[model samples]
Target: MELQPLATFRVELAPVLHVGRTRWGDRRVIGIVGGSFSGPRLNGEVLPGGADWQVVHEDGSASIDTRYTLRTHDGALLYIQTQGVRHGPPEVMARLAAGEDVDPAEYYFRLFIRFETGSPDYAWLGRTLAVGTGRREPNAVVYDAFTLT
Candidate 1:
């Protein structure tokens, strides 16, 4: 199968709310403030009230699970859920966890994305498998999402 570009979007984040370690290791939540996206067939604004729930393991790798929403320019709403992992050298991971701006290429961040929407115009999203490659910024994340074809 090949991958086709679906959309590229930026997720602006609020500060991380550290929930500390539990049975699952270190836990934290990052809030999604606002952002925008555009592509040939999909264009929208990422609505607020979304959050990334993260767990950091002893190896310094992190498991990322995020739930969010997107409102297309035309008013259609898409619910998005992504599961992924982020890992790298200890120093690089430390820098990222500290909210520092490190080159995304220095580490690995990828996600499996799923979309659900009631709008006929976007119904295709629910039937396809998608993936995303992401980069971490100081206060936001940028990702390019692609559908498997």
Candidate 2:
């Protein structure tokens, strides 16, 4: 008999984006570093690991209550569902695999977040908000990727 390992599902802490809103024509930044469930004590601690999230950093962190459709490494994209976008280095993924600490700057790019709110607003950011991913998404989703140059 042949043994195979099915794709078991798991959830991990995603990238913590520095969610900031710009005003005065991008001159000012109003950032909300915390969310609804960032406290020392919460009533939902006994739940499954995925059910409760800990905002370790009050300055910029939150439990992911959102999902996203993203481009896969295979050059295809799918909106499976995402937890949140975290800010860190590629070591985060590596550390998750090896159980080690990694410097946040090691990542090539800062993780951008996507939430599955069913709101059209999640499609784009800032000036790019006008273009929606659409109900019937195209073959390839063009990304106006945000790269810190």
Candidate 3:
């Protein structure tokens, strides 16, 4: 016998709100707006590939601008509206604002995005977004970075 692949994917819809405090005096929280849809489109077309994420403040402020792209050409995509908050107030962002030295790790972070397929429904992949450890340059104007896979 041989194993077959999935044709479609679906995740139950539900609004989510989560929060947690880090060991280094940092606190994080998030609110999932809604489910997203991604299908075959263009390079910047966040579907049939991936999407973007923005880490914002509690008072409706936006942080670093993080984006996700498709590395492979498969019938896969991601879509969702999410907002987050970070506490403890690191100085890296402040330093970058002032003209001083700041380490990326000083404001490290992470996010887990799991993709699930139908029938034998299971997570196809999981992407984690961590500070300092990424491919592109980190945004200082905002609070933190994001990841997707």
Candidate with best TM-score: 1
lDDT of 3 by residue, 1-149 (tens): 33222111121211212233333322322222222222222111222322233443543223433333322234444332322332224445455334455554555433233332331212333332222222112222222222332
Q: Candidate 2: minimum summed lDDT over ten consecutive residues — where?
A: 129-138
Error of 3 at 43 (Å): 16
* After superposition, candidate 2 runs with Cα above 4 Å error: 1-96, 116-149
- Strongest candidate by lDDT: 1
Question: What is the number of backbone collisions in each predicted candidate, taken in the order shown?
Answer: 0, 10, 1
Cα displacement (Å) at residue 6, model 1: 0.8
For candidate 2, the TM-score is 0.21
Q: What local distance difference test score does each model get?
A: 0.93, 0.25, 0.29
What C-alpha RMSD separates each model from the true structure? 0.8, 18.9, 12.0
Order candidates by lDDT, high to low.
Answer: 1, 3, 2
Error of 2 at 20 (Å): 38
Give lDDT for model 3.
Answer: 0.29
| Candidate 2 lDDT, 64-147, residue by residue in tens | 333333322222332332233333434354453354444434432212323222334433222121111101011111112121
Ordered by TM-score, highest first, the candidates read 1, 3, 2
